[model samples]
Target: MTALLLALASSIAYGAADFLGGFAARGAHVLRVVMVAAPVSLAVELLLWPVIGASFDGGAVAWGAASGVASAAAFALLYKTLAIGPMSVLSPVTALVSAALPVAVGLASGDSLSALAVAGIVLALVAVVVVSGGDAGGVRPSREALVLAFGAGAAIALQLICLDQAPHGSGVAPLIVGRTVSSLIVLTAAFALGAARLGATRPDTRTAAGAGALDSLANFSFLIAARHGDLSIVAVITALYPAATVLLARVLLGERIGRVQLAGLGVAAVAVSLLALG
Candidate 1:
């Protein structure tokens, strides 16, 4: 139950981080932002290593690296998708991909859900969509963004699977490896695309740095949750991140949350509570 709450909180933090990161990345050199943020995330995680006492295991390191690869791709694609699509559609769709995968994997692993729990999961999923507040207006989502979003979802799913299966003795080690590898990968990709040179003179760098720190903090919080809880539940709850992101948008970006989304969020909250109880 406690883990579920942590996961839920992690979701909110992650969503807000992502939105801010994406917003900050706009027209700026994606690679440069990644370069600065990834290393910083790694450093922060390293500082937490002593507190978490993450064990060093070959299997855990390997699995974490695998997850890192997926995470690297997920972030890049998610950013790319957000760049070209309506926030409402892209955010929800990408989040759905991230949320749905763990549940599917859990089912394949033979984890059974009660009827009530299933209903809750369904409601939570719907809430994620509503929270995205997708552009119902006349604006169309870019095809490229859609494609990238799909790819990001697939990658995130892969990351979740790897994280779930990773050795459990020390969550910190795996997380450190994951963040370090992910940072390197992002840096490499940025170099390859010459994206590091974009917006060289802009102040968005500060925004990206702040977002990265928050994102890294979210990752740390989630590691604590994931270590003690089922990945299926953790993933689903984390998927609810859009709710936080949407709320932030309302507060910071002056975005509006509709009645339907508010209802969806309420229903989803109840569902999450039920799921945690189960």
Candidate 2:
């Protein structure tokens, strides 16, 4: 029950982060946004280290660093895809792919679930797809954009799975290490893109920093929840983040909440309840 609640919280945080990050991505060099976001996220991880405990064990550090590499790739691919593709298609497809990989890994590793939990997972997935549906003004994404979305989702799944591979005793230390590595990687990428591209648009430093902070919070919740619960279940619940993202868009951006999206939100609530009971 506790894990379920934590997972739910993680979903909300992740959604909020996505909303901020997506908003910041617009009208800037993607690397500029990422560079600001990475360092801010690292700061958040550092702040949490004291409260969450930390140890620089070899296994933890290695796994965390590995995940950090994947994290860099995910951020690059996902943001670029969003810039090129329709949000309606990119978001749900990426979310489904990211969630599916973790669930597959969990089941293969012998994580078990009740039938009720399985049903909840199914509905949760449906909710992600349904909630992400919105008016895109008839703009279809290219095949290249679709491919990038898949790559981004795979990288995200890999990032989280590597974090989960860290030794439990290492606690938030892995997260700290991961954030540092990712920050450095993003910083380097920003530099590699050269100053002309970097200066192409005025950077939204404030929004990017908000994205960074929220992203770290979400990742922390996800790491803790996965440690305590079945990965398959946790991943599915976390994937429901799109619903939260949609809700946030409706409230913050005054985006229209379509009837299909509203129905998806209702289904998400019932799915979450069933998962909690299971």
List TM-scores for all candidates, in order.
0.90, 0.94
The 0-to-1 C-alpha lDDT of every candidate, in the order given, reads 0.74, 0.82
Over 1-278, each residue of candidate 1 has an lDDT whose tens digit, in order, gives 77787887788777777777667667765555566667777888898888877876888889889988987887677766655645556777788888898888877887666776677678788777766554534456777877887898788778777877777776578778988899988877766766345545442767777767777777766767767876667778888877776666667666566776677678778879788667
Q: Could you tell me the lDDT of residue 1 within candidate 2? A: 83
**Candidate 2, which ten residues in sequence have the lowest lDDT sum?**
131-140
**TM-score, structure 1 vs. true:** 0.90
**Alpha carbon lDDT at 101, candidate 1:** 86
Per residue, candidate 2 scores C-alpha lDDT tens digits across 16-115 of 7777777778777778878888899899998888888998999899999998999888877777776665655576678888899999999999988998
